[model samples]
Target: MKPEFENTPLVKAGKRFEIEIDGHFAFIDYREMGHQIALVHTETDPELAGTGAATAVVEKTLAYIEENGKKLLPFCPYVFAYIKKHPDWKRIVDERFEGYNKL
Candidate 1:
């Protein structure tokens, strides 16, 4: 992820986190719930698909969550799987989340 995008949420785009790469935007839609962020969807432009844009955005989102002293609820399947594959991310997950242990 680029340094500029590490914490850039496209306010004009409904508060979703965004990464603009090569004119394409990859985004993760989320909802904030008190101290937790519910990551709901991740999408990459058709042109950015398969180019690791989703993964990059996910990483940045996780980092943002941790940096801000919050936890996450991985409602997005991609984010759940990413946490499963990279267990270190689980540390910042909301333990009360139903799927926390699975991650």
Candidate 2:
């Protein structure tokens, strides 16, 4: 089963992006520091929750980061939790975004 999201854009940069999907769009804002990608925000429509949209967006985002040979500062809680769930991705996670590490 899937949601009715199949033609939406994810991560637009000045009207362009490294990836795009359909139906529902995933919004992500970023800042570059040296060679790292600071993921400022990530969100999908509320109606798209639990429909694999989040994971798809995260995966696409990660792929972009990898292709660019950059690290990630996952500021978005959703991406942070996704990182936790996929520990293999820990290597790409910039320590600066680990705000809860000290707590």
Candidate 3:
């Protein structure tokens, strides 16, 4: 992960966390709930697919959540899979999340 790919506040209210690579944007869409956030979706431009851009965006987003002391409700399947693959990030997951143990 690179600092250059950290949180990009380009979108208002911080609903989007994006990483720009080679002019393509890979981003995660989220909704804030006080100290918790529901990661709703992850998207990468078609041209950027399979380039690991999605992974990087998720990594940065998770880092942002951790750094800000926010709990995660990973509603997005991609994000759920990411957590399943890297269980260490489970620490930031909201324990009350319905699928908590699945990750």
Candidate 4:
């Protein structure tokens, strides 16, 4: 059998963006590099596994970056994949690392 998951909004706090689900927090860590935001990592509570919390956090993070006129340096694989799946967000991706999209 398969499990079900839910999508929740993410909150930005300092250098990380987080989403709370099932009493646990799913978060993405990042670092600012000049005109870009380097997405360093993404993690979710085990209880939230298979849930869409990570995606929600990433979506919000991307929106925040774009809204603030910042580009994305998707060092995290999950963030890279999310951007690949949603090409509309590609506009915020750093062109210097365009090679990553091929991976």
The TM-scores of all predictions, comma-separated, are 0.87, 0.70, 0.87, 0.82
Error of 1 at 25 (Å): 0.8
Off by over 4 Å in 3: 1-14
lDDT per residue as tens, model 2, 1-103: 1343334434547522333444545556677788888877776677666667667777777777877889888877877888777887777776666563621
The Cα local distance difference test for each model comes to 0.84, 0.66, 0.85, 0.80
TM-score, cand. 3: 0.87
Q: Judge candidate 1 against the unseen true structure and give its global Cα lDDT, from 0 to 1.
A: 0.84
lDDT of 1 by residue, 1-103 (tens): 5565555554325768887776889999999888989999999999987777788889988888898998999999999999999998999999899988777
The superposed Cα distance between candidate 3 and the true structure at residue 38, in angstroms, equals: 0.8
Which sections of candidate 1 miss by over 4 Å?
1-13
Which residue pairs does candidate 2 place in steric collision? 6-22, 6-23, 7-22, 7-23, 8-21, 8-22, 8-23
TM-score between candidate 1 and the true structure? 0.87
Output the lDDT of residue 73, model 2: 83
Model 4 ranges with Cα > 4 A deviation: 1-9, 98-103
User: Taking the tens digit of each residue's C-alpha lDDT, what string does model 4 give over 67-95?
Assistant: 99998899899998888878888898888
**By summed lDDT, which 10 consecutive residues of candidate 1 come out lowest?**
4-13
* lDDT, ranked from best to worst: 3, 1, 4, 2
